[model samples]
Each structure stands twice: as C-alpha cells, then as structure tokens.
Target chain A: MDYKTVLTTCTYCGCGCNMYLEVMDGRITGTIPCKTSPINEGKLCIKGWNVHEFVQSPKRLTRPMLRKNGDLTEVTWDEALDFTASRIKSIKEKHGNDSIAFLTSAKVTNEENFLLQKFARAAVGTNNIDHCARL
Target chain B: MIEEIKKQVRELLTSGTIKGFLGLREIDGHIAPYLFCDAEDMDSMNLGDYKKPGDARYPLNRILIHLLSHYPDEILGVLVRGCDQRGLNGLYSLNQLDPEKVIPVGIPCPPELAEACECSRPYPENRAVDGQAEGYSNQTLARIAGLDIGKRFEYWMNEFARCIKCYGCRDICPMCICRECSLECGDLVGKGDIPPENPIFHLIRAVHMADRCVDCGLCAEACPADIPLRTLYKKVADIVKKEFDFQAGYQPDAKSPLNVLDQ
Candidate 1:
C-alpha cells in the first residue's frame, strides 16, 4: 500500500543524472528518469535505468567474508577489520610502504573517498591511491 | 489555449468525473509529467511552452498506462498530443487499455514540431486544438531504400555497430507494452555481448515495431547512440501499411493484420 517515488542522483558515473526510484512497500521496484532534470532531460543511460536491479539482486554481498581453509567464510566486522589491518601492516613492513596500494569505489561518498586517500598516504605511507571510476 | 485545457481539467476533477488528471507540470522552470489528483494542483499545470523550440516532451500515455495498471477501475484524464492519441488507439485495439476508464484532452503540435516529426496528422480526431498537418517525409529511409543490396547491408552494419546495447530506444517506446520482451531471450540474443550481434538486435526490434509504432520519435530522442531508430521503425510501419493496407492507430477498433492470424 505504500507507494512513492524518491528523486535521487545516479551513482554510476560522473554524469550525475537525476532519477526517481519507485518504491513499493519499501522495495525498489523501478527507476524512472527525472524528466525535468537539467542534467538528463528525462533521458537515461543504460546504467542509470537499471539502478534498481542491483538493490534486490540475490548475488549481492550481504555480509563480509574472508578466505578461510581456501573458502570464503562469514566473519564478524571486528574480526574482518583486524585481519585487514594486520595484513596491511605485514605487507607494508615486508615490502616497504611504497608497495601498498588502495583502490576505492565510486559508490562511496566524497567524505569516505577523502578518508580512504588519507589512509593510503598517511597511514600506509603510500601514494598509490586510485578510484574504480578511472577504470 | 492552455488556460482552456486547465479549466476543463479543473471541472473534471471538481465534478468527480475523474479520479486523477495526468499531465505536465512545471517545477523550478522544468516541465515534467505529473499526476494531478486534486483540483488545487491545477495551478501548476502547464501545457508546455510551445513557443520554446524543442520542448522536453515525456510519454504521457506511458505514464497513464503505468497508473492504470495500479488503479484499473478508476477513470483518469490524460493530456494527449496527436502521436499520443495514436498510441492510445493502438493500445486500445490491443486490449492493453480499457477505453471507458480513460479520457483524453487533445493539444495539437505546432507546425514546426509537426514538420520536424513529419507527422501527417498532428491533431486528434476529437476535441483537438486547431493545427495544420504536415506532410510526412523520411529522408533517412529514402536514402537507405535507394542504396543497392550490398550497400544497404553495409549501411546497416555500420549503423548497428555503433549500438552500445543500451536498449534505451526500447525502454522509451510507448507502444512496447509486453511484460516479457523477446529481445531479452538468451537463445535469440546472446548474453553478455555489447553491441549484440549486429543485424539481429536491430532487426528484431524493427520487426516488433511493425504494427505498433506510432511514429512518436521518442525512441530516437532517447537513444544516446544517435541511432536512427525512428526511421527504422517508420520503415516497418510503412511496410505494414503497404502489405496489409492498415495504418496502426488510425482507427480504434481496427486490429493489426499480424494480430489476426486468420488472414
């Protein structure tokens, strides 16, 4: 019974097209391009139009997993963060700070990206920081 | 002219004749399709600035169909251009829409837009605002038709090669109403291939547009690849007209020859 359209911006690329995400009962049902948007003018790229598909995709990762006994096993956030920190520390120590690199995603916020680059340069002492959008 | 349409819409809403009026509304200097459920919303209703060339036009009929799917029995009033009226006729013939559940307020396209679209009839048959009809012409279709068989094959190959397999043209088309589209069939169209196997992708869509295309040109407008999709679909419409002596959306009750297998 709860049907509504939430206007938002597309996160796939730099174009930043606006669209309406049709939500029915809290589930993303479809994507409609914002016709009045100054950026897109009611037209959408393929990625912008299919933004809802990934939300409900069964294949999407819901929980963090780590390789244990040569298989991915569900792990708690504390265990996963500790594992990652320890691995990064070992790698940096063994092969120098310059050997470490960080790859960020476009899906995250600008603040999160700033923190990631900061972590790469300040924490890991490496300038090797890049984003997936570049690929 | 827009004032008259708004007045009629307000009357319809206030009299309880229609549950909702689907039309365009201007918000922050941008016009978009909106569902006006209350008489007070009529203050924002805009018939589009016809003086502005190349006005942003959305598929009002497509939005109407989506709304109708949710509220099947409720009567809704929709703003329609000539092409939109034709689309409604085609939908009605196909039994996709219940004629009694809808009302159309017609606004004819201006001469410049009519010529740009090359529309033969730029006004609906009933309750239409006055507008001159422009002769239909498809230079792209004519140019392609003039080419030799080998040249024609090369022309289409080059055109189809630029396709990014976005399916934007299909997604924007108002006449494409099926829940399960054949273009998505894995067997017919191979999976995970960008610019899907040249001729098949374009050909399959062209065939599907045979008796359904209303020459709205929205497909070409939506295509990011700049493919001549409207011309391709127009050719299909021409073929149906020539072969079956039937023009889609011209008559409400007329069934497409392809739909009538009893030929």
Candidate 2:
C-alpha cells in the first residue's frame, strides 16, 4: 500500500488554501489542511475539506452533455462548444448584447475569471457580467 | 528529540514488541501521519515539527482507531503528545481503543506550542522530554466569559455568522467518532442553508461536546471562518468540570458521566 500526502492548493475558490490530499494506494481518500501554509493557516471551508470527494465521485461528469428533446444527452466536446458558440451568436444577433448575461464561478482562477469578463465585455459587447462569489 | 523518539520506535520495531509504529513521517517533504512497520526505514520518523513544534500534528489516535479495527490482535506503537494521550484516554473510555493492544511512546510539547495551544496538560503520563513549556492562559475564553448575557449572545452570533457551514471543525475533531451525527440530520439541520440556521447548528455540536472536548484547539484552528469554537467547547468542558466535577481525557479508566446513561 503506497500511502502518502500530496500537498496542493484547494481548487474550490480563489482563497488558494493549501491542503494535503491524503492518497491511499494512489487514490485520494481524504483532504487535510497544510498547517504551515501562510494563506489559510490550516483552516478550510466546507468545499476545501470535501475537495477529494469530487475527484472519484460517481456523479462527476466525465463527458460533456447537451440538452436535446428536454433531456441532457452526452455529446462530444467539439459538438458542445460549437452548439454553445452558435447559440450565443444567434442570441446576441436576435437581441441586443445586453440581453444575455455571463456568469462566472468562484471555483475558477482569478486569471480565468478576468478572461471571462473580458470576453463578455469585449467579444460579446455586453456589460451584463456577474460572479458567483457575489452571493 | 526527534532522534530520541526514533530510537524508542526503532527499539520497539526491532524487538518485535509492536507490529507497526504509528507516527508522523516526513515523506516527500510533507509531514503526515504514517505507520512505520520496519526499523530500517525509521529514519523518516518525525515529531510533527516542520516550521514549529507540533505544527503538523494529526489525530493519531483517530487513525489508531482505524488501525485497531484492522489489526485487533497485533500490538502497535503510537506517538502521543499531551492532546493525543487525552484522545487515547477518551477512546479507551469509549472502548474504541484497548490500552493493552497499543504501546504509546509520548513526548512533551514545547513551551511555545503549549502556550500557543493554551494546553492545560502538555505531556503524556510517560514523557520522553523533560522541562517542557507550561500551559498558557485562556485570554479569549476569559474575554468572552467576562461579557454579560446580552453581549455574549451578540458576540457569539457575530462569530457564528461567519460560519460557511463547513464541517471542518467537526471533521477535524478527534472526539467526534459517531457513525451518525446530529448535525447531519436533515430535519434538525436543514439542507441548502448556508451558515446553517443561526445558532442551532453550532449549539448541537456544543451540547455533544459537553463531556468529550479534550481542549485540543484543532476545531478552532481548522475553522476557515476563524470562529473561536474551542472557546465554546472549552466552556462546555468547563461546565462539565464545574457542574459534574468530571473532566474527560485525563483518565482512561474513568468513563465520562455523560456517556453513562444511568447517571
């Protein structure tokens, strides 16, 4: 049994909390906060503590899904991205750019969030942008 | 001190006294709880001192509980500090661990760690280190306890308000070892409520810790919201001490009165 703790940053939020992913036999079984971390100082939120649950979760989506006939159907990444881009373009053309709102998550990195807002404002020409962390 | 503990653990493993030595090891530059089965690899044994003494402490007794279930007949050697020994005592009282099945090699907390933790007892019964630090005073507890009822209510409410509904405090607690927990009950604690229904979520835990909190301060340290949870649990311990004349974690032979149904 190869048991070890891999020190890494929590991917839940922008908090950048350091945690140790307790790997048992090469599978992440638990999460423990890194005590020496200056950022969180060994403290973690509900999300950070349960970070390992998502990696091997049976409910986790391994493939992209698209709604067809009122049901989410598994689709290829290309198909999903193409459908999303086409829909966004059609919506922006039919209605004004302000009609659609782009919402981002705290789970994404600061750089990613910045790019998303930049895309919404410049590419989509809409000021209707918000973040999940606002709540 | 690290060498001293290693020497003891190495002796135990070489002598065939213990099947495995449960302690912390610095593997891959990360200090974590580990079970060393051979004396030759005892070089990686650590006393949980990374940046400071006792900084990388884990619930070894809690891990020991899992170890005992798998290896009931085999004798295991475990590392223990003051808090760990207390945890072992609590486990013993609950029959979660058998004293005869385990050999605990303990070390005393440095003065800085004791002062930082405000640990009442800074060493196990059999201490490997001498002239350790004295336990510090309770300034936070004192300040909160000094407040009147109205102010106290407001103070705790503000602190509890910062709750992200994280179960880190409960999850990190060594005393929390029930198969089922009241905090997780859907009816008692509603689902999808952030910050978890005001004081009820925290109150349930406090009531449960009335006779079990070992004053480890891990709960407070683990809280992302920085809630002074240890103060609340410590108050429960104080109440148990004052009202019941009982303290948990000091003696393994003595069962907590709260756990005893007959009273």
Candidate 3:
C-alpha cells in the first residue's frame, strides 16, 4: 500500500525533463512525465522515459574495482582512489600533461561535472576535457 | 463553465458521495491532474484550459486507473473530457475498472480544440457542458493510401526507421494495459538493435491497437520523433470496424471481437 510518486529531473541529458518516479514499497516501479513541468510539458524523450531502468539494474556497479594481475578485483574506496591517484601521477610524469584526457559522464549532476573539469585543469593541468554525451 | 464544474465537484465531495475527485488543479500557473480529497480545495480546481488542449490534456483515465487499483472499494469522482470518457469505457470493457465505483463528471471539448484533435466525437453522451464538432479527415492516412504497394512499403519503412525505440507511444496509450508487453519479447524483437527490425516493431503495436485503441491521440503527442502514430492506429480502428463492426469504447457492455472467441 506504500505507493508514492517522487518528482525528480531526468539526468539522461541537459533537457532536464521533470518526471515522477512511481515507487511501490520503496522500489521504483514506473516513470510518469510531470505534466506541470514547463521544460518537458508532459512529454519525455526515450531516455527520460526509461531513466529508472538503471537504478536497480543487476549489472550496475556497486563497488570500486581495480585491476590486479590482469583481473578486476573489488576494493575499498580508499584503496581504489589511492591506486587511481598514483597511476595518474606516474602516467602524467611519463607522458606529459597533454597526453592525459578527461572523459566525463552525463549521469552525474552539473556540480559533479564542474568538479571533474576543475580537477582536470587545476590538479592534472590538462586542457583535454570531454563528455560521454559528446560521443 | 469552470465554475459550474467546480461547484458540481464540491457538492460531490461535501456530500460524501465520493472519497475524492480527480481533476486538474492550477498550481504555479500550470494545470496538472490532482486528486482533490477536500471540498475546500475545489476553489483551486480547474476543468483544464480547453483553449490549449495540447498542453492542458493529460491521460486522466490512466491516473484514475492507478488510484482505483489501490482504492478498489472506494467510490471516486473523475473529470472526463470526451477522450478520457472513451478511455474509461475501454478500461471498463477490459475489466481494469469497475464502472459502478466511479462517477464521471464529463466535459466537452470546444469546437476549436476538437478540430485541432480531429476527434470524431468531442463530447461524452451524458453530462456534456459544450457542443460537439465534426470529425476531421486524417490527411496523412489518405496520403499513405494513395501510394502504391512498393511506395507504401517504402513510406512506412522510412517512418519506422526514425523510431528510437522510446516506447512512448505504448507508454502513453490508455488501451495498452497488458502486464506483459509482446513488443518487449526478445524472441520477436531482436535484442540490442535500435529502430527495432523495421516494420515489425511498428506493425506489432498497430496490430495490438486493432480492437483496443480509443484514438485519444496521446501516443502521437508523446512521441518525440513526431511519428504519425495516431493515423496508423486510426487505420487499425477502421479495419476493426470494417471486419468486426465493433468500435472500442463506444459501448460499455460489448467486448472487442478479438477478445471473444464466439463473436
């Protein structure tokens, strides 16, 4: 009996179509376009309609993975971040700042994208930045 | 007109006739479907701005179906335009709704809005607040019919090629109430292919709409690719009418011939 609709914005693209994620017993069951949303106006694209599919997908990554002996191994956040930082440092030292390019994703918030671009320019000193949406 | 509808809703709510009245409410200058449970909230209730039917129109019957599933025993009042009333009747025939437990407060589409929708009948039989308009001919179907066999095939293929596999048409359809959709069957529709095996994808949906489609035009409006889905479904409806002499959502008690074996 715990059926409720949580209004949220679609993260698939920059259009930011507002929709209601229909939750039944704490699980996302369906998506309904928000009729009052000025941006979408009750119309949703393909991605916005199926945005809930990835939430509880069995193939979704739950933990960080690091390659150990050519095989991906699950590791703690600290260990994974440390491994990433150390690898990036070594790669930049050998190949120069121009060699490393930063690829961002559309699934994250604009604030997260800003942080990624900032990290690329300030920390890594590389101007090569792009997004998955671009591809 | 708005005041009259609101007063009727308020009376229905205050008299304990229905637990809730489902209709559009203007919030922040945007009209959206809402369940007005309290009679006091009728002040903000709206019959929807029929002047701009495209923006104001919503699948109110779909929302009503959702609410009815949870509150099965409770009698509820719903605001129904012509298309919404047709959808409600379609749902009733399919056994998805109990007609007795629901009260329909019907409204008719203005002639301009009806002409825009190209709707056959823009007013419900009972409780209409406006006049009905003549149905407009679908030019797209006429154009398609004029083409030869090979050209017709090419025309449909070109249209189907633009499909992004969004399923928006199916999602917005009031008649598509199946728990398991055949379009998603991996065996029928090949996995991981966009534009989904050409005419097969669109044809399957058109066939499904044969006996069930109420021609609300929501599917066409919802499609991002601007596919002429309503025209295709209207053709299916025509076929059903020609072959079975049954029009969906026209009669409450009669069932679609496709659903019955001894029709």
Candidate 4:
C-alpha cells in the first residue's frame, strides 16, 4: 500500500529534468515527469520514462574492491583507500606526475567531481584530467 | 461510423480467421478499449461517439503489440484506421508487431472524424474490410507551416503548459520502444517538479521521434491537457523527411535513420 511518488532530481546528465519515481509497495514501478516544473513540462523522452531500471539493477556497486592475483576481492573502505593512495604515489614516483590522469564520472555530484579534480591537481600534481563522458 | 465498425467486427468474428477481435467498447457512457473474444460480444464494441473517443487510435496498436509480446504465435485481428495503420507500420518497422500473426481490418474514417483528428489522410492504404469510404484530408501541417516561427513557438509553449504528465502519449505510442527513455534521462531533464521542464522533455522526445512518428494523433488524444503535441511532432517529422529524405511507413524497404549507423 506504499503508493507515492518521491520527488527527486535526475542524476543522468546536465539538463536536470524534474520527475517523480513512483514507489508502489516499496518497489520502484515507474516514473512520472513533473508537470509544475518550468523545464520539462510533463513530457519525457525514452530515457526519462525508464529511469528506475539502473537503481534496481543487480550489478550496481555498493562496496570497494581490491585486485589480488588478477582477481578483485571486496575489501574495507580504509584498506581500499589506503591501497589506492599508496598505488597512486608509487605510480607518480615511477612514471612522473604527468603519467597519472584523473577520469571523473558524471553520476557523482558536482562537489565530488570538483574534489576529484582538486585531488588530481593538488595532491597528484597532474593536469591530465578527463571524464567518463569521453570514454 | 459506429454501426459500420460494429457490423464489420461482427463479420470478422464469425469469419473464424481470428479467435478474438480488439476494438473499442462503451463503458459507463464512455468509450474504452475492449477485447471481443466471442462473436456475440460484438454488441458491446462501440467505436467513436462515446466520450469523444479519447485516443482510441493507439489502443489497437497496443493491444496487438501486447498480444504479440505474450502470445507470439497467436493470431489476433485488429480494427485499424489510417492513424492506427501507420502506428502498426511503425511498430512493425521496430519488430514490435508481427505482421504475419495479426490481421488488420482497416476502417475508413468519416469526414467529421478526420476533421476532428486533423488528419491528412483518413483511410488506410491497405484495407481488408469492405465498404470503406475514400480517404479524406484535413491539412493541419499546412496551417502550422504557414505560421511564423515565433508564433509557433508561443503556440507550442502555451499548449505544452497544459500537460498533466499522464504519459498517455508515450504509453500509447507504438514507435516508442526502449527499456529506458531519453525524456526520463535525468542527465537531460531534472527530476521532481510539476510541468517538468518546458521544451526539454518535449524537445528531447521530438528529437527521438525524428524518423519514428507516423503522424498518428494519439499523443494529442492521450494528453489530458489537450496539448497539440501532434502538430509539434508532425513538424519534426516533416523536418526529418526534408533533411534526411525519409518518411516513416511509406516504404517497407526503408530504415529509420535513428536505428542505422550514420555511415
């Protein structure tokens, strides 16, 4: 009996069309484009219509992974972050700062992307930065 | 028109070519889609003149597609008019509808209905039913084309503002087949607000509809707010044909530009 449309921003791209995820019985059933919003005006392209598929997908990542013997093994955040930092430091030391590049994702928030670039420029000392959109 | 459609459905049911016939039925003084399984059930199959026949064009296409999706081998006969036929063609192009399994019973639209829909051609090119009237024309494109660009934009803005976001247009569209829609793409359109974004939701759809829309007026009918979405998409289709030298449903040999690689 949990039938309600939770208002949320579309995390897909930069246009930011307003919509509601229809939650029925705790299951994301469908989506409805917001009518009162000034941008989209209650119309959705094919993508907006099926925005809930990725959220309920089984393959979405929930935890960090570390590769050992060419196999990725799930690990704690502290272990994963420390491993990443040490690996990056070694890579910079061996190949110079120019060899390391930061590839960002569009799914992350603006603040996270900004932080990633800052880390790449300030900490990593590399201007070779790119985004997921290119690859 | 109602009586003629009923008689044809009755004949088709008795003809034994189809086990079930899908058409419109009267319910509580309104017309809604119904599946006439029994020949006697043709009594309830009401066509038009009931609740203004709000978007009856897409239901037959949906019913046929639904049947094909679940019962791929089963043969179901459908009552198709000009718009419905075009929709069927679009669906067939997308492989959503199986041409061999379903029988199309074409119905010629009357002059008044044609005028109401603002359709260019009211009769389907293919007809299985007998006594269908000649195709009629109501040139909505010419009128829209004659308008200035600014006026047209203002007109579309006002019309789109009345949208209720029921998604009846997308639900009823036969050509729109994607697990995820661009309109829903939060990347392009933001989430959580009424009226959504103005031209983004609609403009994105228009871009997607470039070579797909069959000039069926179901989107306009499905719009609870009576937005003239058909006119806008019709313009888009026109642009596609003008630029790409392509028209949907006119030729089975042709492929929609969106599906093919740019080369």
Candidate 5:
C-alpha cells in the first residue's frame, strides 16, 4: 500500500536524464520520464521507459562467489578479496606488469570507476585500461 | 460534421432501439471523447477544427467495447467514420467485440477532415445510417510512396527519436490487446536510456502492426511527438496485402498472414 515515486537521474549513460522511479509497496515497478527535465524535454527513449525492470529482476547477482570444483560457491567478502589479490599477485609475477589489463563498466558510479582505474594503474602497474562502451 | 451526427443520434434515441450513444464533445475549445446517454445533450457535440484535429476512434472503440462487455445483450448506438468503422470491424474479426448488439451510425467525413486524415474513403462499408459526404482524395499515401527508402528511414528515425514511450499508441490502438507488451521485454529493449534501443521499439511495433492496423490514425493523434506511425503501419499493411493478398477488416473470413499457415 506504500506507493510513491522517487525522483532520480537515469544512470544508464552520461546524458543524466531526470526520471521518476515509481515504487509500489516498496518494490520498484516502473519509470516515468520527468516532464520538467531540461535535457530530455519529457521524452524517453524505450530504454528509459523500462529502466526500473533490472533493479528488481530475480536474475541479478547478489553475492561474491569463487569457483570450487568447477562450480561457483558463495564465499565471504574477505575470502573473495584475498583470493583476488593473491591471483593478481601471481599473475603479475608470472607475466610482466604491462600484460595485465583492466576494463570498466558504465553501470558503476564515476567515483568507483576512477578508483578502479587508479588501482589498476598504481597497484597492478598496467596502463591497458578500457571500457565496455569502447567496443 | 458532429452536428449532423448528433441530429442522426436524436432520431436513433427517439426510435427506442438504442439506450445510449457515444460521440465527441467539445470542452473548453478542446474536444474529448464522450458518451451521450441523453438525447437532450446533442448540442455539445462537435467536429473539431483542422488546427486541433484529433481522431478519437480508438478511445471510442474501447468505450464501446467496455460498455458492451459490461452490459451484455443490450443494444447501443455509436458514431463511426471510415477509420473507426474499420477499427471496429477489426475488433469484431478478432472476437474482441460482438457487433450484433451494436448499431454503428456512420458519419462520412467532409473533404476538409478527410484531407487532414489523408483519408482514402469517408464512408463505412457497413453503415446503420446514411451520411452526406463524398470520398476523399488520396495524395499523402502517394507522396509517401514516392519517397526513397533511405529518406523514409531517416524521416521515421527523426520522428521516433522524439518518442516519449508513453504507451499512448498501444493504449489508443483497438488491436493492441496483449496484457504484456514485447517492448518491455528485457533483452530486446534496454533499460535506463532517454531514447529507447534506437529504432528497435518502432520496428517491433511495426512488425506487430503488420496484420493488425486498419489504417486508423489514432496512433498518430495519440503520439505527442506527432510521429507518422500510422503511415508506417499503412505501408506495412499494403505490403502484407500485396504479398499475401490479405486485407485486414475486409471480411470476417479473411485470415491474417501472421496467424494462419501459408497455403
């Protein structure tokens, strides 16, 4: 019975279109293009209309997992981070630092992406950084 | 003209054959679709100006369908032009409507309104009451057919880019009956972008409209962007007819290309 529309910016791209996420009973139901948005001018592309579907999708990944006996098993964040660090360390030792590469996603926040690239260049010592949108 | 239709409605109401009628009523200079249950309220009906021309066939069709469904075995009369009559016929063929309990009072569009709609015909194939108007000239379709494919594509793309995805087209369409639309399908239409997966939404809708569109201009009128969506569907319908020799709403026996197996 808790129906409300939360005003937010579209996170799909850099355009930063304003929209309203219609929440029905605490569940994200749909998106409404903000009529007051200066950039979009009350129009939404097909994507903007369906922007709220993925947030409540059952298929979304929610936990860290490690491959165990050819199958992914749920693991603690500490274990996942330690495993990632050890693997990267081993890979750097085996191959040159320049061999490793990093890829960023547009879905993540700008601050998080900047930190990821910073870690990749400073810690992993590789400049081979790219993004999904590059392709 | 709406005044002429209202005059006819008064006759039908006085005949005691119909309990109510549906038509458009003028509201503060803008026209909205309305149902006229009383014969005394015919003064408010109007056929709008060219500057504010609108096709209320979709909403009127829905209102009629809803009324018939709610009150089965009741006789009701409605105002229909050629496009609205075709839409009603399409609905009847799909079994979405039962035409036996309804009386369609056909009101032929004047040359001016027909020209505005780019209409080829002004009278219904099946009319309960006769109307006074000649068939219209066909120029827009001919002009559209003269355009090159590349030019047509660009014209449609520009129009579609202005789409707000209001579902107004589907909402207004008499044939779009699916409770869940494919445009909301996860993989096909992406999420969180101002412009939907470029041209995919329009293309998908066109594909769906191939056998469904009855040349009603409701989609164009419902479109806030003023996209010529009905023209695209009209072209697609022509292609379907040329290839399959199947015309929608022509007859109840005629089968749609999408549903029937190719013989």
Candidate 6:
C-alpha cells in the first residue's frame, strides 16, 4: 500500500541515466528507468537496473577488514587505516611506487575520485591510478 | 481524448462499478502510474503523454496483475493501448489474469506514436477515444530477414556485443512473469560474464518470448545497449505465426499454441 518511486540519476556510469527507485513499505525493491529523461529515454544498462540490489545486501562490508593469516578479520577504523598505511609504505619502499596501484569507483563522488588520484600521484608518488568505470 | 476517458471513469467510480481505475497521472510535471479511486482528481489523469505521445508507457497490465493479487475480489479498471489489450488477452489465455476480475478501457495511439512503435494494431477493440491510426508494416524484421546467414550472424553478434547483461529487457517485459528465470541459472548462463556468452543468452529469452510476445516493444526500449530487441522479438513472432499459424494475443477466444507449462 505504501509503494512509491523516487527519481534519481544512476551512479554506476557517466551516462547519468535517470531512474526511479521503487520503494515498497519503506524498503528499496526495484529500479524503473525514468521515461522523461533525454539521456536514457526509458532505458537502463545492467548496472543501472540492479543498482538497488546492493543497497541493503547482507554481503555488503559494513566494517573494514584486514587480512590476518589469510583470513579477512573485521577491525576498527584506526587499526585498519594504520595497517593500510603501513602496508602501502612498506610496499613503496620495497618496490617502486609504480608497482602499487589505486583503483577508484564510480559509486564515490568526483571529489573523492580526485582525492584518490591525488593520493596516488602526490602523496604516494605513483601514477598507477585507475577507475572501476574504466575511465 | 483524455476527457472522455476521464468522464467514463468518473461515472464508473461514482457508481461503484470498479474499486479503482489504473492509469498514468501527471504529478509535479512528471508522469507515473497511479490508481484513481472514487472522487479523486481527474485533472491529473493522463494518457501517458508526458513529453510526447506514448512516452510514459508503463506495464499497466503488469501493474494490474500485482494489484489484482492484493485485492482479489474487487474489479479494477485499466487503461489499455492496442498493445496492452493484446497483453491482457495473452495473460488471459495463460490463465495469469481472470478476465472477469478487471475491466479494460481502451484508447488508440496517436498516429505519430503508432508509426514510431511500428505497431500493426494501434487501436483496441473497445475504445474511449474515437480515432483511426494506421499500423505500420514490420520493416525491421524484414530488413533483418533480407540478410544472408553469415551477414545475419555478424549483424546479431555486433548488436549482442554491446549488451551489458543488465536484464532490463526481461525486467520490463510484461510477458516475463516467471518467478524462476533460466538466464539466472549459473549452469546454463555461466556467471559474472559480460555480454552473457553472446546469442545464447538472448536466444534463450527469444525462445521463451515466441508464444507470448504481444509486440509491445518495451523490451527494446528498455535495453540500454539499443540491441534492436524489437526486431529480434518480431522475428520470433513471425516464426511462430508461420510455423504454427498462431498470433499471440490477437485472437479473442483462442488458447496459447504452446500450453506446455500452465500457470
């Protein structure tokens, strides 16, 4: 009875396909392409169509995990960040910075993607920066 | 055209002939599917013309299916284009929808919309709007058919390669009401691969659509890859017509040609 559609743009690609997230009983249930948008014109790719699936998925990573004895164990923010920084530093020192790489996602904002590339080029001294959207 | 339809609906609602009328409504300049009840606002009622004619076509038949399940005993009024009427007939033949439970208020598509869709039947049998629009011949299917076997394979492969495997085509299809889909079967489709192993993934769906495609073209419209799905589905429909002499959803009382699995 409480079904409604919330209009929004797709976060998976630069195409900016507009879509409606169908909310039923306060839970995100499905995705319907926005018909009026000139960009997509009532069409959606696979990623745009299934954008709601991962929102409340049980497999989603809520806490940071660190590889301990070949097992990913959940850890606090400070501990995980410290571990990551130390690992990156050691890897940079052991091998050239080019050996390491940074991969960003389309899910994040433009500023966050900019920060990631900045971290790779200026902070980490590596130009090995890439994006999940294949940009 | 919309006023006459609205007037009829208002009369039906006031008389308690139907529990609700399912149609598109323009809300804050955006159009979406809405169910109108007794004494509701008729000004917002639309014939799915947001930017242009036939632009905001939702699967009303599909939505009606869901609505009927929630309110099993009540009769609901639905707006139907020629394509939608066919879908209703197909659903009826398959026993997915009880013919007695819903009332379809039909409308003919505008000539521009009908031509854009290349729909052979642009007017429903029972119509609220009075108009005649010519149904275009199946040119896309004929164009594809003109190609030789090798060129046909190359043409289809190039089109299929653009597929992101988004399943939007299936999701948007009104005929695709099956709870269990074969495309999701890992053993058959092979998981986590883009383009979904080419023609097989598409062919699997095409085979299923043979007996039930109402020629709505929503799947092709929903496909982000622009995969010419309408052409493919139309070809399947043509094959079914040729081989079995059956046109789905076209006949009033005829049952499905393939009744292999009953609902």
Model 2, span A67-97: residue lDDT tens: 9999999999999999999999999999979
- Per residue, candidate 4 scores C-alpha lDDT tens digits across B1-263 of 55666776677778877767767665444344556777787877655443243333335576466555655666778887877777777778788887887777777776667777666666777765554444444377778778899998888788778755656687757677888987778888888756878877888888888788877676765465777778778788888888888877766557787677876
Clashes of 3: 0
lDDT, candidate 6, B1-263, per-residue tens: 88889999998889998888888888766677777885466778988887779888887788788778767788989999999999999999888889998899999999999988889999888898799798899877788889999999999999999998889889988888999999999877988888689889999999889988998888988887889998888888889999778888899677767765655
| Model 5 agreement with the true structure over B127-246: per-residue lDDT tens digits | 544554565554666687788999977877897898777676775577787779998787888866656776988889988888878776767765667788877787788788888887
> Across residues B1-263, which tens digit of lDDT does each residue of candidate 3 receive?
77888888888989999998888777766666677888898888777673375456667787778878977888899988777887788898888999998899998877777777778777776773555556666666778889999998887788888888988888877778999998999988997788789788999999999998887888887877777888889889989998999888888778889987783
Interface RMSD of 4: 10.2
Model 6 misses residue B161 by how many Å? 2.9
CAPRI rating of model 6? acceptable
**Chain A TM-scores, one per candidate?**
0.93, 0.92, 0.95, 0.90, 0.89, 0.90
Which tens-of-lDDT digit does each residue in B50-89 have in candidate 1? 3363366777787777778887878999988788889999
Between candidates 2 and 4, the one scoring higher on lDDT is 2
Least lDDT summed over 10 consecutive residues: which range in candidate 2 chain A? A1-10
TM-score of chain B of each: 0.94, 0.95, 0.94, 0.85, 0.85, 0.96
| Best model number under DockQ | 6
Candidate 2 chain B lDDT trough over 10 residues, lowest sum: B128-137
Query: For residue A4, what is the lDDT in candidate 4?
Result: 38
| Candidate 2 CAPRI grade | acceptable
Per-candidate Cα RMSD to the true structure, in Å, reads: 2.9, 3.6, 3.3, 13.5, 11.2, 4.2
lDDT of 1 at A90: 97
Using DockQ as the yardstick, the better of models 3 and 6 is 6
Q: Per-prediction TM-score, please?
A: 0.88, 0.82, 0.86, 0.61, 0.61, 0.81
Model 2, span B56-100: residue lDDT tens: 887777767766775679889899888888888888888888999
The fraction of reference interface contacts (C-alpha pairs within 8 A across chains A and B) present in each candidate is: 0.35, 0.63, 0.48, 0.00, 0.04, 0.63
Ranked candidates (DockQ, high to low): 6, 2, 3, 1, 5, 4
lDDT of 4 at B131: 47
lDDT of 3 by residue, A1-135 (tens): 345557789988777898878675688867878766778777797788887888889998899998899999899999999988998999999999988999999889999999999999999999999999888
Backbone clash total, candidate 1: 0
